[model samples]
Target chain A: MAKSKKNPLRWVRLDNAAKIYPAAMRKNWSNIYRQSMTLYEEIDTVVLKSALEVTVKRFPSIAARLRRGAFWFYLQQVEAAPEIQEEKSHPLCYMSEKEMSKYAFRVIAYRNRIAVEFFHSLTDGTGALIFLKNLVAEYLEQKHNISIPFEQGIIDRRVPPKSEELEDSFLKYAGRVPASRRDTNAWRVPGEKEPEGFIHVTCFKADVDSAIALAHKYGCTLTVFFSAVMMQALMNYQKELNPNTAKHKPIKLLIPINLRTLFKSETLRNFAMFTVPEIDARLGEYSFEEICKAVYHKMGYELTQKHMSAVIAKNVNDEKNILLRLVPLPLKNIVMKAVFDRSGERKSCLSMSNLGVVRLPEIMQKYVSRVDFILGVQATAPYNCGFLSYNGKVYINLTRNIRDAGLERHFFEILRDMGLEVTVESNRN
Target chain B: MYCVKCGVKLEDTEKICPLCETEVYHPIVKQEQVPPNYPPDKRPPAKKKTKIINGVVLFLIFIPLLTSLISDLQPDGAINWFGYVAGALTLAYIAFGLPMWFKRPNPAIFVPCFFAATVAYLKYIDFVTDGDWFLSFAFPAAMYFCLIISTLATLLFYLKRGKLYIWGGFVIALGFFFPLIELLLSLTFDLRFIGWSAYPFVVFGLLGGVLIYLAANRFARDAVQRRLFF
Candidate 1:
């Protein structure tokens, strides 16, 4: 049943993985993203707005704003519907704390697309995807006068949210094990960054079957193959840019692993930790097969339940520390901000997050044309790549703040060489 | 239609690429001009009126101030305790309330202003009490405070790296400050110099020297950082 008038507004805590985001955000950087789904027809704003009004109520976590208390930052429930805007020029634009305090996310509709950009302090890509899927379902249902059942990550807004859906999975699944992984600074891609607040988004479209065939040929999954390819591209670029320093620097890709599969928790907040898959160029140049093997094996070792649990335990243990708890919020923000800047992007050349297959109901799939996931650029790391496959098409969206197209060119050339048809799209304003 | 620069596919209505601001142009495709219906500018949620709260607090303080002023007025038409009370209230206003008037009041400016207010308050107290210690004791005390605060402020503002040296200097100065204070007190009160201030001076002098030594040596600095890695 729909949340009743008497059902009190529920405020939730920031998930364990989400605690650092609010503190780490700056004017140029707020870890935010825009996950958009394109339809064959122009978006009907009226239906989209009404659909959001109902759908957001289902996601109490996303419907809330970030609030700082004496102890920690939290999500406070907001009763009003989020303002739906026409698609602006940029995706994943900078969101200030003031904006975050008012609304942690936004919904935009333009032409054949409806995108939801979220301040990652509220939800991760999975959590955001859940909200987006529900919104799309409601939109399609209202627009076409059809009832779309909630399944495959879609939720019925009429149903009240479960307590487990709102739980902080990190705290719930934390153990005594300590995290052991450490990374040296990775090779940085050198290029002049575009003007502040401007991001260069390049979407590389390729056939899913061909990409998968290529991955299968190498005995690796799609993500592993892509990681190897990206690392290879960076290694080549580093050698091209500065061959002397290339041997000294390691090429590492920071890949976020979803922990929900292991913890058995269904919370729609951030329940993920990143594993750094690195190649030591000092050891010598690695062949494509060797790189793929390294990436596949490393990802297999790092993404295990035991390893992920230890990572979560380390983060939760820090949060649970009595001394850290006693530190004032302002002081904690300063320290966390410093730690986030120094430790976040320094050890990774770039980030590659693949959201796997995006499945929709058969009835709803007719109206949807494509889905795109755009990861925001980091402070130090200029570019980040996010891929999502829907239907037979794979969308490789590269969000970069730099002016150089060398990386993207090299990346697409690799695909083209493999006989996979590639179409490059960009928001080049 | 597509943006020529960053190359993300553009909507038919879009005049330019939203991400890179590159103008959208396609030789074959004619541009359809439909202005986007963007959401109204989100007026940053009305900020809380801290100024009004400060005004209310100032008003509350004024009531007691007025009462004190009225009570302090003697039948002989003399402003006896009123001067001290009014001076204190003025000092309180300067120290606490004045900064609220500006959006971002610079600490560099306000720190000295606060010290001036404090010194003025001390002078007013000395005058009201008919004491002659303003020059010998109170002035030196205020100067000492200003010296420490200004030194710390300058270090915080200017010194970006290797600030331990500035800290060590401040500590050493602070150590010497106690002896000067003791000498001033002995001179003013006609008390014998019992050398009590020398104890803290010696203790802090050693501490400051050790810190200075650590700041001077690169090896010692790295070792301290490793040991105190928070």
Candidate 2:
């Protein structure tokens, strides 16, 4: 692909969800995560570098660096390709402002996996996954000399990047009606945090068919079923960890909804929102079936076109407010930080994001064995669970900064007792 | 392999999950060999020094110097007032500008330079006005203050223990320095020795004694830590 003689100094406004990340990002908490794909063969650095070199140009938004404006933060196109480093032992390590001042994302090649960790301000999981898949495809094309055509989610390097690819989808889909952002404080997980700020990741592998069948038995989607299972696990642990407070506290699960499906957005930037399904244990002890029923109905109600529209509109409305728009970026950051501290992570005890089945092109699928999505632990919500299923296997990745493995242990045990075989793996040596 | 607890995919060689510390046990894939992808450990990268800030500082310093030189030259053929301006500018450069040149400048060295600069400026002012205060009052006052500060700084830099005791000693020394300042002032101005300096001497002397007494008690230190939440 030839470099277009277009104006190189291009910049774009941050999407609605992207705005919160820049303000909330701190030294101890970067609000970043690594979304990676492991190939069947060892990664060749030379080929991987060439792949990223050509692929980043196709997704112009991913190649940009974050810049501060008078009233807001924007992404400015960078001329130099980002350096792809060897994979570090810990994934999603805290990125200081100093490191972020250079670039918003980095590519790492280690063994069979090529991971891209992005500062959340740049894009959401869906957008990031698309970029990674394209990089891998490009790598395969360059290394193996294969003609793998661009598929639905992956970008084609032969064509120039369209303007719509950088569009702020929230503004496009925002309606006039505003939604309520008020939420009661959810039960926070109790545990000791690793002093050195270590994050523990535990991945569980289950048969995709069995998990789906279990969800089907409850007459709900896989995400709802998983969320219910997670909430139940939290309830059991809360009973053990804080027996006195367990009855009063509400167990809520955060599900980050992909807005693209509902809004028909082709924008590769952030376009996701969250809907929290909460269960108050004070009412009574909830059986697994009852919890599943509640989660299914609540998710169905909240994720409807009108209800989700109000959620999107509310955030866009906040951003579009005359007073908020007039405030400078620094002052806006203070407001956003306060709002996030009070309302963002406080609404949920744990977050469970399901990337769903990651379908690849037949040629690419053969080389890819596992697909994983990792969400970093937030300041308040110390534990977060991410799910990605591929090739008949479901991978559940639980990320926590706290020392206790009780949550993960309980979660998998529940699934195992329910007659589904569960296999666990960890990076801990 | 993946961590059954956190669900993060892991390299096969890891015996435990790096994130959660969950032991790795895959029933299906046992020790089929591959070298570790990551290195043994990670060391944080060195922070990049911003050279541009030094350039900006130099430019800012140049502006005031150029302005004073031009204003002084236009009014007179000689650099009479410009010498004073140069002295003040030199002092500013030594205090602020010189530190930007090195990553870490020893406070022991800079502190002495600051004293020397203050003394030089005082001498310059005296020479200009044909005053008689530099040798009697200004020099002694500046030297005593500089000596006290350098002593405290030396103790802080070199000592690994008894910081509180050192501070208590310095406070006591400061209490004693007040009367000497008064004595020098009276001698330089040809005035009678008034007991005015006694107020601060009593107050600081009492406070210093109390601090020394507290520093001598281990229980006091522990109590302070508990009370202060340090």
Candidate 3:
């Protein structure tokens, strides 16, 4: 909501889940993810800008910029939307700290595609998807003179912003007993890094029915199936790199689970946690079936309401600690950065975030040709995988900052070997 | 068209399979002219503006130097206390400011330069004071310190692996070098030694031994890594 003259400025404390991003951000690296929709016609920047202007007013938390206070970082509402930029190089190009302080998200236009790249501190994929869908709906209504329905994540801009949508759900649902934060560090994937910081995005388009059938054959969900396949690929890569079987570390994939499905919160802020399902390579070789079973059970165990509440309690309790709260923001950032480096990306080889399936209203679906979700590679880790099914096809995006393509090759090859046809598209020349 | 090696279909814009780098070829189907997923314009992220900060730092360094020079020259016609201030500021600039000019400063180059600047500063001080200990104490002491540090920097910067081993060896070498420093001080300054160096040598020797052991023993290394969360 826009601040009145009496208030002057409206600011909100970063959510418990968002507090780590501002601290862990580097000069050239930020936790960024992209949600895009490719329409049947080329994007009109003039109309897109107007659409964003209207859409931003509906989501106050997503329309804010990061600001540093004495003890913590907060988000201050910006009156105007960030200028819609033309996609030049790649998706999720580094959003520097200077840029984040001004705008936490950017709207990008390229040909027929309209993409929104957001800093993780702003919102998770689910929240960002809702924002994107509404923005696209507005754009379509304005450009094509179509009256799209206000259902299925396309919020009505006429309604005032609700307080519940901006509430920090982590604090609301924290339990008394906190979960243990102890976890073994997973093996890191190594590759020759691109010197110029160019991100390579590769998309694998596969049939939704085929992938679902394969997942059903293994008696696991699609997310679990993909995670197991990714772990298998990582296992093969690690084995190729290190022949000594005894020295192999546990191969783990950090799978982000949307807490909205489990909890009864409707806030658009970050409301997701990770379930690290791993296969210990040090023990012995694991078959695909075994890996799938391991991932399925581990995810099931950690995805429970009690287990997730404990995890949320642990995070919220850290925010409530008096000693930590008294520490100044500069010193706090150093401590938070150290903590993130120790337990964050190091505990998983890579992250595979599946946004399950995206559905839009009937009126908005005709103009949209494709929808994609892309998660940037972790700051230290070189690779990350994100995918979502939109119509009958599933778009599996594999993004990496390194020169090696072994992981992508192995992952797609595994899918192809399972009798599923995969069509590949990439930004790399 | 599909990648022959990867067995996955390829987009029309893909000349080669991104996965296996296998060239895409078809018997009859020709590659069509189509726009890629992303735009052709490659706008790399803007690099941080270090030049402005470097200029500001230069200005900051100049302020103190100018103040000292003016105050010293105003007091006397010849420079007296200004030499000491200038020498120290010069060393500070060489150590910190000079490296800020490069995007990725080579530590191997900068480390040697910094030690050389330290030695030169010490020599300048000795020359100004007309001290007798310049050759016997300051020169050799600074040179030895430079040698050790430069070697450490060179090895750590050039070699990717064995960082633990290098640090361990360096620490052990320091354990031996401390005693030598005590001997040099005793010889140059004619001071009575209380065997203080041996205490540090014992501590460093044990610490260095542990580091080397950790480097050698993978099991211990992994255990320590897990415990320390390094």
Candidate 4:
């Protein structure tokens, strides 16, 4: 059935769940601290009344609520003082409005480059994507002469702020699901939460104009094809280290799928979950197209309504330690930890966030040299890849807790061999 | 990231240092919390004098525990229940004593587990040895202690860290319970169980040890880093 309402997007601020993850309020707070990094893109366009605006104006309350927290809060306020100590020269994200011009929206790039801060907290990528969309839409309407094309019956521009609910529809999907694989032995870690590092690299700018065509030629989106290549590269990396157990080793890649479309929520604290996709080293050694097809099929299965419900239900309820709410802080940590262990069902070896096809306005698209988003290297693994698309080009960034980075070359080599010319860049700090 | 623990330089070598780990020293006297790396606000008037005193006291305590471990390989008696007693007491002390060291604990679940585990240990040992008064009195006493330990531990953990605290307590009780329950049943029934059956108890102790160690070290390090307490 079609969603019951035209402005189906809704976001709810949970009173009970809001107090936790207080790290957001602490000093040196960035959305990235919670591992919640996002890019805010603005296209300064002479307002064109389009069908999309009609759909968006119907959802202003939804649009405005999205900017209330995290990256946007920092972006909109622009008064946050840097909390980093004077003695230290840490690369911190100080507020910047240098890009605001005769434009409809604000483009803020959040990069999670800190190597030591992954798995600190959970923020679903979908939540960030929705905020990005809302920020752009809101900026377009307010700053520029944009109007909703209500004649197209796109969406009713009639949402009163009072009518909106802060809660997300996908909240129903939250809970712990039965493990698909039983026994840690089958899972093959045997309770060894080992520290892993990555060899980080980049496949800098690929030909974005023909990205879809190249994808069709290779049988994948720029996301799946490259991710598959990443999978294969990781497998080779593992082989170089553990040659004896090469055949059965399952190379794991944490693939993040934005949940904005999956769950139409405008509230943007965290609304994304990732699918951990793994390929046997043999499967990893397959042709790029085959790996891409395999991943596409896997991701397709996960995003389905049936699978989304189960996954969402599992995550929320698994973290549903109500006792943590009622009990004192000292005593509550026990239950909180149980919640952590239960919710921490590792799906892959490293995190991969593909912010596919970043939109830019006509104005600032010129002087802006390039844009890149970063992912913090977490305990689950040594490195994670965060890539953003800007100005018809994609920038790949990797962060790791360990010093020597190795994912760049293998990633590019796989892409090159798969019939595509890709640019390369490295921030050798 | 400055030396929040002991004012020591932070680098690869100082990933997490020992002085910070134990938190025996603090340099500056600050209100509320200090930077983690800073040691206690004031060191003892004399360092070498204190270290020698601490070393002597530590050796005295270590000698007997070491001797008992080496001396009794199930010798001098039909059953070396002392091993069980010693282990239980240590668990109890760590669970209960350490937290009680402070009047107001930062995370308060530690004390009750000590008492409850101690009670369980005592009852388990008794039921195994005295076969005569096994259930009439022993089970109730042991279970009563278990209930208190579990309840207090659960309650305190919930208050401190929410659900995390409870999960931790459950793991602790479960870990210790493995050996205690089996030993109790074996004793009550007079079943001929081999030493191989007791292997799980070793695993339980190992798991218990690791959890306590990590929790203590992590807590201590965090406390130092936050400069919440000296």
Candidate lDDT values, in order: 0.81, 0.82, 0.89, 0.45
On TM-score, the candidate that comes out on top is 3
> For residues A1-429, could you state the per-residue lDDT of candidate 4 as single tens digits?
012254453433432222233223222222231121222333333221232244233333222221234311111111111111221112222211222111112222223111111111223333334333333334345555464232211223345432322344446445345334321211222221212211222225666755557777866677776677778777656665556553455666667666656765544334555666667764435655667777888887787656665676754563455643445543444444344334432446667778776544443233234544555443334556777676776666665444333444456556566556664433221
The i-RMS of every model, in angstroms, reads: 7.5, 5.7, 3.0, 16.3
RMSD of each: 16.3, 15.5, 12.6, 21.5
What value does the lDDT take at residue A266 in candidate 4?
Answer: 48
- Go through the candidates in order and give the clash count of each: 12, 27, 0, 79
Position B104, candidate 2: lDDT: 70
Candidate 1 residues lying further than 4 Å off, grouped into runs, are A1-8, A245-248, B1-230
Q: Who wins the DockQ comparison?
A: 3
Q: How big is the positional error of residue A410 in model 2, measured in Å on the Cα after superposition?
A: 0.7
Isolated chain A TM-score, each model: 0.96, 0.96, 0.98, 0.61
Q: How would you encode candidate 1's per-residue C-alpha lDDT over A137-229 as one tens digit per residue? A: 999989999988768887768988898788788887776797864658887887776654667677777889999999999999999988998
- Sorted on DockQ, best first, the list reads 3, 2, 1, 4
| Model 3 bad stretches (over 4 Å) | A1-9, B41-230
TM-score on B-chain, cand. 1: 0.66
* DockQ of the candidate models in sequence: 0.05, 0.13, 0.33, 0.01
For each model in turn, which proportion of the native inter-chain contacts is also found?
Answer: 0.10, 0.31, 0.74, 0.00
lDDT of each residue in A324-412, candidate 2, tens digit only: 99999899999999999998888899789998889888889878888888888987678998998989999888999876788887787
Q: Is candidate 1 or candidate 2 better by DockQ?
A: 2
Over all chains combined, what TM-score does candidate 1 have? 0.66
Worst 10-residue lDDT window, candidate 3 chain A: A1-10
